[model samples]
Target: MTTIARSEVLLCEARFYAFHGVMPQERKVGAEYTVSVTVGYDYAKAAESDEVDDTLNYAELYELVKHEMQQPSKLLEHVALRMGEAIFQKWSQAAYADIRVMKNNPPMGAACAGAGVNLHLVNDKTKKC
Candidate 1:
């Protein structure tokens, strides 16, 4: 008999400075942003194989997020969604992904830590087009 295992890879609180807002100053001056990503996958092989190739490469994941952040967007939702899609497209083993994008000290006339969007995506291999 064999047992199945479920696991997740997380890239948390990655900080970046980029242009990602709907204002002129935001695009010109850029702002501090934080991005977090969670990817669901089965890591049972890597746990035993002890090989980096057996599991999702977190460094690569960071690169994906960094690439998406470089492309300026007017909405955090757009950024988050793109990140999620990139993860799924790159790694077919990914079952699902949760992405969060936050902008620190938003210009919305309020004293707050940050404001942004969270996006969840599922890979439906059985879904027919």
Candidate 2:
């Protein structure tokens, strides 16, 4: 019998000021973005060892997201996708990644909170879309 070791690390609502939108004003003035990332990996070793090296580092993950955010994108979807991909690329041990990018106070004429996009990614190369 075999047991699957699964665990997820979540970074919630990390905020940043970035330029990512279709409107020119939005691109110039920029807007506040909130990014939430979930990383899945085997946690058995980390749990047993209780060492930082045995698990994913949250700071490193944040840096990766920050790097991606610095590069402007026209759409939240693109930013989310890129962040997911970058995380997976940087951390080969990550089995899955979920990224969400939210734009605060979207200028849609209506009194709206924000706009966002969520991206889910798996390590399987053949399964990517």
lDDT scores in order? 0.89, 0.85
Model 1 lDDT vs. the true structure? 0.89
Candidate 1 C-alpha lDDT tens digits along 23-72: 98898899999999999988889888999999999999999999999999
Model 1: how far residue 34 lies from native, Å:
0.7
Model 2 off-target regions past 4 Å?
Answer: 1-5, 125-129
Q: List the residue pairs that clash in candidate 1.
A: none
TM-scores, all models, native as reference: 0.92, 0.89
Report the Cα lDDT for residue 26, model 2: 85
In model 2, the Cα lDDT at residue 69 comes to 92
Q: List the residue pairs that clash in candidate 2.
A: none
Candidate 1 C-alpha error for residue 32, in Å = 0.3
The 10 consecutive residues of candidate 1 with the worst lDDT sum are 120-129
- For 1-129, candidate 2 gives per-residue lDDT tens digits of 556545788899999999888988888999998899998877677778999888888998899999989998888888888888887787777888988888988888868777898888888743432
